[model samples]
Structure formats: C-alpha cells, structure tokens
Target chain A: MNISLQTRLLLLMSVALAIGVLVTQQAGRYESRRTAAADIDARLGRVAHTLLLSWQVSNDLTVASIPALTVAPPAPDGKRLPVFEVTTFDNRVLLRSHDFPLRTHALRAAGPGYGNAEIENTRWRVFTVIDSQRRIICRVALNEHDRSLREATLAPHFDQPLLLGVPLILVLGWMSLVYGLRPLRRLSRELARRDATDLAPIRSVDNDAIVEIRALRRTLDGLFERLRHAVNAQRLFTAAAGHELRTPLAGLRTQIEVAQRAPDAQQQTHALERIARAGEHMEKLVSRLLHLARLDSGETEIARHTLDFAALVARISGDYARVACDGVDRPAELQGDASLLEALVTNLLDNACRHAPTDTPVEVTLAHHDHWLTLHVRDHGPGLPEADRARAFDVFYRGENTFGEGSGLGLALVRAIARAHGGHAGIDPPSRDGLCVTVRLPAAHRS
Target chain B: MRILLIEDDPILGDGLQVGLQQAGYSVDWLADGALAADALANDEFDAVILDLALPSRSGRQLLADWRDAGQTVPILVLTAYDALDDRIDGLDGGADDYLVKPVALEELAARLRALVRRSQGQADNCLRWDGIEFNRASGILSIDGQVLDLSAHERQIITALLERPGQTLTREQLASRLYGWDGGPESNSLEVHIHNLRRKLGRQRIKTVRGLGYRMAQPDR
Candidate 1:
C-alpha cells in the first residue's frame, strides 16, 4: 500500500535472501549428521575385522583366559564409551568388551552388516563383521544420543560462512536495485526542473538506457511533441482571431465616421449601406468564431438521426439557387447530426461563393458506395497549391493566392463537423481548374 | 490631388473611396494588392492609402516591392494590426506613415495631406499664388482674408494647379483631375467650369497658354 519501488524491491530481496540462508543452514545440518554417522559405521567395521583376526591367532584358548580386548576406547572426559562384542555363527558370545551393554545375546544376531539396535532402553548404531574360516562374528556399536550431541556441538562452525555472507548479499542486492533505477530518477528530476511552458523533448541516447526506461522516455517525448503542437496551434488561432475581429471592428468605426462626414444625402446613403454590409460580415464572423470555440472545447452535444443525404443536399442547394445544385437525385441516406451537417454545407457553399468568380456556379454531388456516402462541393476557381492543401483545414490558415475577406474558419469548421459525425473531410486535387472539397460519412441502411 | 486607395474589404474600401472623393481628392480605388501594385507602377498619384492584409498579395510585400522598384509615391499604411511589432515592421518595410484602423476620417484625410505635402517638399498645408491662399486642410481658398465659395470641380482644378504654381496644366490633365479616368467631363465641361472660375475671380487672374494649357498669372504688387 503506497510503497515506493525501491522499498518494495528491497523487501522482496530480503525475504528471498532469508529463505536461501535457512535452506543452506538446514542442508548443512543434515549433511553433517550423515557424514558423522558414515564415519562411525566405517570405524566399527574395521574394528570387527581386527577382532576376528585376533581370535584366529589365539585358537583353542578359553574365553576367560583371552586378554580383555579394548575394541573402543573410553571418552577422555568420562563420557559414555563405545561398546563392542564378538560372537560365533550359532549366536554364542566368543569375546566381548568389559563395558558392553548387552551380555545375554550378541549386539545383533545377523552378521556382516551395519544397523541400529536397542539395548537397555537406549538406541545404538551397531556394525557386525563375520570370519567364515574361524566361524566367528564381531560387532561394534555407538550410542545414538552421543552422536547427535556431537553433531549439535559442531553446527555453529559450519554456520560461520552463512552468518557473514547474508548481509553482504542484501547489500549487493540493494546496490543493484539503486543503480538500475538511476535513469528513472534522472527522468523525474528532468520533469521536475521543467517549467509549465517547457514542452521540449527529453534528450535520449540509444546505448545508455535500458529498454524499459528508453520506452518510457520515448513515450514522454511523443507526449511533449503533441502538447507543443497543440499550444502553437492555440496561439496561432488566438492571434488570427484578434486580427480578424479587429479589422471588422475597425471597418465598423470607419464606416460610421464616413456616414457622419458625408456631405450629401446620396453619399450618406452609400456610407450607411456599407455600414450595414460591414455589420453583417462582422456578425457572420462572430458566429463562426463562436462555433469554432464550441467545437474546440468539445462542449457541443451532437444529436444524430437517419436522414436522406441526397434530399438534404438538394434542399439546401435551393437556398443558393444561382450558385449551388445537387448533382445526384438518388436517395443516399446517412446517420449524422443534422444541424451540424447543415452548417457544413452552408460553410462550404459560402466559401465557394466567396472565392470563386461571381459567374461560376458551385456543384454539389452525392454518391453512395459500400456503406459510405460522399458529398463533394466543387468550384470553378483557382485552386489551392499542393503545398497549401495540407494546411488548408488548419484554423485561420489562408493560402497565399486566396483573394477575399474571410474569417478563415470555413474549411476548418467543415472538417470539424465532418469528424464529429465519425466521418472525414479532404480536398481533392484540382482535375481541370477548381477545388473539390469532399466529405465522407457512414451511410445508413435503407429502411 | 489624386490619391490611390488600396483596401481589400468591400465596405471599408467603398466608404474610403466616397469619403476621399468628397474630401476633394480624385481617388482611384483597387481592392486587390496585385492590381494596386500594377496601378501604382503605371499611374502617377499624389499619395497612396494602403491596407496591409490584401488579396493575392500582402500590402507590406507590395510596399517593399514598390520601394525597390524606385516608386517614390508616398504611401500611408492603414491596417487593423496595431501591435508594436506590426507597426515597426510596417514602417521599416518602406511605409511612409502607419495608422491603425478605426481611424477617424478627418485624421486619415489630414495624414494623407501631410504625407503628400512632405513628399512634395512643402512644410505647410497652404498653397499661395496671386493673393489667393488655398487651405489644403479645409479645401478652401481665401483672398484678402475673405473666404471664397467654390464648386467641387472648381476646387479640384485650383488645387491641382496650385500644387505646382506657374506651371501649365493641359486641358486633358485638368479634366482627368476633375472627373477621373472613367468619367471625363462631357462637351468641354472643364471650359465651362473655367468660365465660371474666370467670372468669379478676375479674368486676368488665370492665364490661357494657347494650345498648351492654363496657368495662374502673377499678382501686381
């Protein structure tokens, strides 16, 4: 919960190291016990072999007369001593040590093997060796409790390496983690040092960064580039708007002054007429600007409905009977926001009329193919250059050859409206002489 | 005085044309920058009023081009761009004077007059000859401290001749000044106006240079 990357990594490393240490310690304990038990068994087998050889050398002697064979010596500090015994194949004791725990029967009835036995309520590890030529079996045993106590005494000696190595492992793990995250820290510092307006991409190198960090840096750089473009566009839009609005306002002021200064009723009438025309231009400009602002803010709600595209174009073209006409008569229906569609058509028509020569008629064509309805508005005017086509839809971008008083938002608004209806707008290359702006939208199924 | 007005906006251009015409200056208006540039190259005018944002060519580019081409007609820039940088750019780009839009008609007229006077190497707005002082600002002529009422056509002829005193102005030049290139006066209208001017002021006050033109005669001391 709310843990930093470093802390989480360190915690995971510590837990893993602790488990490794525990497993190593447990394996060391088990191996040490096994090695000690194996050593005791080998020693007991050697003693049994030696006892059989001794008995063969002193054949025909009485058991009481045989020297007391000290098969295993006593402990130096008076601990319990190891026990040994020699027996015949028939299970009769032939020789035995003085401190042997069992005298009524041999340590084991079987011969030539090593195993565990219980004697006088204590457990012992016993080994037996047999001499077939002498018909004798010799056995030696050690207490299980004593062997376990010896193993316990030697545990810390084996654990000394583990005790010193665990902290070193943790330190190394933490260092690697810090070193790996250094790039991330640098990225954060760079972000923190930046001002709000600084949208420059972060510097990056190919070889120095790991893959993950490099990916992160690349994504952030992309974001910065997008933001910078958006900001520049916004700045351009505002400047263009200020320039556009002020010119008309200036016209209004100058026209009013002209009207006031008119020497005669005729001149006054002409000035007043110009004033009215300027007011209309300004009104159109303001409304278009407000529409663009709404689109930019993403605040306008679009209500979509199924409508006949061909019929809509035909009806709207009638409003500009002299300049516009629908080229097709078929029912090409589509689903879209109707008001926005009307605005789109109106802006296109207005743009064509404004740019084209007064006598040239604007052609509106509609076609349906593969669930798409395409609306094309073509004008017989000097079309935009290839270089200007790309930026024609950019807000307030008027081409160099363009001649008119325009708000420069007509094409941009058309594209915006088209996009809102899940469609797109583009300018086709001039085939002969003129511009053909095309809008493509999804066609509704016939019902 | 004849002035060339270059503005792109229809309403503003129309109003400036009417207002300047009423101010007693024969004005030729072009709404396209390229056309205005061509007109400036071909025609001679006392001054030019230019708008910056124009069709086909920007006014700034046209001004720079005209200056490069050694056209010395004084140009006054009238634009809606009032920012400091825009003003600096306009002035540095060979504009004679810069005025932001929403400009008063009187101010624009005064500035145009001043630009014209400065270009003609005159320090004041008064042109005097033969005891008649022409007030360029008021478009009025006063003799012996008494203002004389005159028709618009008579004012145009006197203003044109007074700008260059003692110089002969041909009938065609005076007729163009009075009624522009499109509408020249019909059936010796210039003679009729001259007849009326000779009737009002003393007949010898104007000299008829036969087969050449007319000039203002010197007054006796």
Candidate 2:
C-alpha cells in the first residue's frame, strides 16, 4: 500500500502520542493504588495502637470491648479497619470478624507487624495489626464496593487531586502535543496549497524547519532548471536540422529542371552531373543529422580501447591522400576513433577544399605535448571573421561564401565528439595564407 | 524522349505516366527496381526516373549496378525524404538527379528536358535559326551583324521556345518558366510578356500555333 506522506506522518505522530499517554496513565494508576494501600495500612495500625493504649481485650462488651475501642470494630462493615485476635498476650485469636478475609495468621507471619492484602474472589482491601500487651491481633479490611464513600472521608487528604487531576493531565498532554507541532502543520498546509511549479520555500518562524524546507526547494528548482535546458537544446537542434535540409532540397529541384530541358546528350550529361552532386549533398546531410541526434540522445556508447595516436593519424592522412591528392597537396592527419576521426578529418579537409582555391595548399600537422595531443588543419582559404569564429561551431552554421553544399553539422558533431572524449575543438589564428583549426585531445594518462 | 519511370506507388506512377504522355514523351513505368534494371539492360531509354524506395532492389542499388556496368543513360532519382545526406548518398551511388515526391508534372517534364540537355553537353547558349541566332547566356540576338541586347527574362522565354524550336508551349507552360510554383504572374501575364518580346524581336520571330500555344520560328531573314 502506497501510503501518502501526509497520512504516514499523521499516523506516526498519533501512535507516539497514544503510547506516551497510555504509559503515563498506567503509572499514575499504579502510584495512586500504592498510596491508598499505604494510607489504609497506616490508619489500621493507628487504630490498633489506640485500642491497646486504652483497654484490654475481653470476652464481653465492656467499655473496653466497644467496637470503636476494640480496634475500630473490625473495620466497621464497609470501611477497612484493623482486625485483631485477643488472647492473654500469647498471640492466640481473641476475636475474628471481617468484611473481607483477614488472615489472623498474618500477625504470626508478620512477627508483630501489620500490612495490607486483597481478598481473592472479593473486591476488598485488608490491613492487619497485632498488640501484644492487649493480647490482640487486629486486621482492617474494607469492601471496595463502598470505596467512594470511604474516600470521601479522606477527600481532603488525597481525594481531590487523584479523582479530578488525572483527566486534566491527559487533556493538558493532548493540548501540549498540538501546540508543539503547530509549525509542522503550517508547513504542510503551505506545501499542500502550492502549485507544481511553485518552488518557493515555505515560510516558517521556526529556523530548523525553515532550513529543511529551503533545502528541499533548492533541489526541486535545480531539477526544473536542468529540464528546461534539455528541452531548449532539443528545440535548437530540430530547427537547425530543418534549415540544413531545405537548401539541398531546393538544389535538387534546380538540377532536375536543368536535366529535363537538355536537348542533346552532352547537355543531359552535364545536367545529370549537377543532380548527382545535389544527391550526394543530401546523403551527407541526413547522415550527419542522424549522428548528431544519436549523440544528443546519449545513445552513443563508444567502445574504449588503447589507441596508437600517431598510427591513427598516419592512416587517416593516407586515406585522405587518395581523395585530396588531385587538389592542393598532402592529406590531413588525424588521431581518434577510426570511423569518427575519418568523418572529422573528411569534413575539415572537405570544408577547406571547397572554399580554398585549388592551387593553395592545405596542411595538417599532429603534435603531442606533455599530456595532450593536438591535431591542426591549416588551409590557404578566406578565413572566418574573428567575430564569426564562435558561431562557427553552432549546428547549421554556414559561412558567407562557402561554395559547395554542406549540412553544417560537421563542426557541431566534432564539438560533441570532442566533449564526449573530454577534449576541446576550436578555431586557431589564421596564417597569412588562410584559416587554421586545432583540435586537442587529452592524453590517456590525463583522461 | 524515351523515359523509364520506376515508381512503387501506383497513384504517383499512373499520374506521371499520363502527364509525361501529355507532355510528348514516351514513358515506360515499372514498379520494381529489379525489373527496371532488367529492362534497362535489354532496352534503350533516353533517361530513367528512378524512385529510391522501389520494391525488389532499391533505386540506389540499381543505379549503382547500372553505373558499374557502364550504363551511361541519365538516371533521375526520386524520393519522399528530402534530406541532404540521402540526396548525397543517392548521387554518390550514381543517380544522375534526385527529386522529392509530390512534384508538379510540368516541373518533372522540365527536369527531364534539362537532364537530357545536360547529357548532350549543350551549354545554355547559342540558339540557331535561319540566318538569325540568339545567344541566351550573353542575352544577345544577331541577324547579319545587327546585334540586339535582350532582357534576361526575354532571352529565357526565347531559349525555352528554341529548345524544341517549332514545338508549342502553352501560356501556362510559359508562365511556369517565368515564375516557379510561388509568385506566379497575374492573369494574361504570359500574353502580355509574349507581345512585348515579339515587338522587340520582330513579329516574324515567333509564331502562334493556333489552339496549341506559342512557338519560336526559323525566320527567313
């Protein structure tokens, strides 16, 4: 059962209060009983003492044999009074009368003492005493059926407090609990009335409670902030993807129209070539978009392994030499995931190749420092404006005069991969001839 | 022009077939890439309109196979997805052109004409006639050293007519050339534009094919 927090909290508090009140009530009842028994025993012993001082025990109702003179007349029916055995001071039973069972042997068992006892099957209390000089043992017993009447006589002593004070204590205890938890109730009401988006801390006069509420509010606010950021990023990506796809679609239409009007074989071939180029542009854009989406969705679980940085760079450069050999000169070097690195180097070199004059040289160099590996691609092309350098890495970012069709996710993907690998990518200061870009990867030890 | 159209969707294929027939091209339609490839191997087609998502074998793969086998017939790839990466991949696999779905019939016909023109290596210039000639790229019309500078749109209209010299082009077709799907001219705009062109180029330069459309004539200067 998924118990709500409020219900659980209330139940816990209620259980604690009940246990506390019950224990206190049990203790108070036990203490009152002890005090009452002690008082009854004391009074019975006093009566026995008075009888011993004034008269002697006899087998007749002389002035000394009067019930009040004879050990309080065996507790006077319903009142608990001393019970005694009168003999020739030899501890023999002189008289034995009782409202409840008063054990005469209690005098012998007590060795000339008195105490209180309860009768088994009857609601009674008994106190016994002995007087050796009077040759009498006295016991006081009382029926609890008339307890209220007897307690009325002792009301001035302990009755008022015991009878009236217990319920008052319980009522006061309940009020005290309610007062102590007032701050908690206030916090609950404040939270209950709040909207889901309301992250403000509940105001409280109690410092400790306020601090806890503030901490909770901070955590919730932080989570909402992160959620907003993620949603914004998704929106930006989708808009950029749409714009990137539009240009190629427009280009395709133009290519097809040119091909349709081709009157001869040669014109048709030229028109076909333009269409092919447009198609090639479309393919790369789709793949790049999918790649970015995969990375953004955190679905890229890149396999990690030991890599030879120099070897990887040489291999990529060798592969690029086949494609880029016709133009400029040497191929670009790169070191990273063979597939991902190929895409990275391809995009960079391709960007340079499209923008730079065919005669200008594009150079790539890889260098390793203390704990970093940096790959630099230099192109003798019109470099990006210093102002546009930052915006260059944004998805679908296109420069002013880039010639061939491009998706514009090349640098964005490169940036994402760099961050994923705990590295960084950025544009460097251009040489007099053209632009330069440097990508730095943390060495294995640093990583 | 004999064109092979490999489209899987029956509605689009039927529409394209009827449209191409109306536009004066012989169109052979196939629903499967494999059958299209087979037909291409056995028969001669001036051009091929290949849908990328064809049954049996994908259009891209068919184009690749045909190109690998040295088939030089112009292949125009058609697809629903207009993604750049998909376009690039299609072209890279040897498709001559890529077009998206829901294309206008006139636009498709124009594209086929362009593709055929490109395959012939014809530049966008040099329209020849009886002793008079028009150069579209340079916007110049020459008749025995009398050079006339024509506006770009006039040159485009003349060049379009010169593509099929004596063939009729409806007013709607002329309007399509002037304005794309968006921002078309107002009513009777094509006639007004043609009248202005005829007055500048001389009345005999163009002929109105009755009940058909307009056409450029080989003038007997």
Best by lDDT: 1
In model 2, state the lDDT of residue A220.
Answer: 52
TM-score of chain B of each: 0.92, 0.58
Q: Model 2: number of clashes? A: 69
**Candidate 2 residues A1-447, lDDT tens each?**
997555565566667656765676666556566666567657656755554554443435553345443333434555645344444456444444433244444334444454333455435444445554445655444555445455555434544454565567556655765665565666677668978755444445453455665576566558767766776777777866765565455446544654575557775676567667667777888888887777667798755555665555565666554222222133323334656655666777777665576777777777767677777778777888889899988887866545444456888888777766668889987558677877787766633
What's the TM for model 1?
Answer: 0.81
lDDT of 2: 0.64
Candidate 2 segments exceeding 4 Å error: A2-25, A45-68, A71-78, A84-105, A112-221, A303-336, A353-359, A369-372, A380-388, A400-404, A420-422, A429-434, A442-447, B1-221
- State the weakest 10-residue window (summed lDDT) of model 2 chain A: A322-331
Q: Fnat of each prediction?
A: 0.61, 0.00
> DockQ of every model listed?
0.53, 0.02
Chain A in model 2: its TM-score?
0.66
TM-score of each: 0.81, 0.52
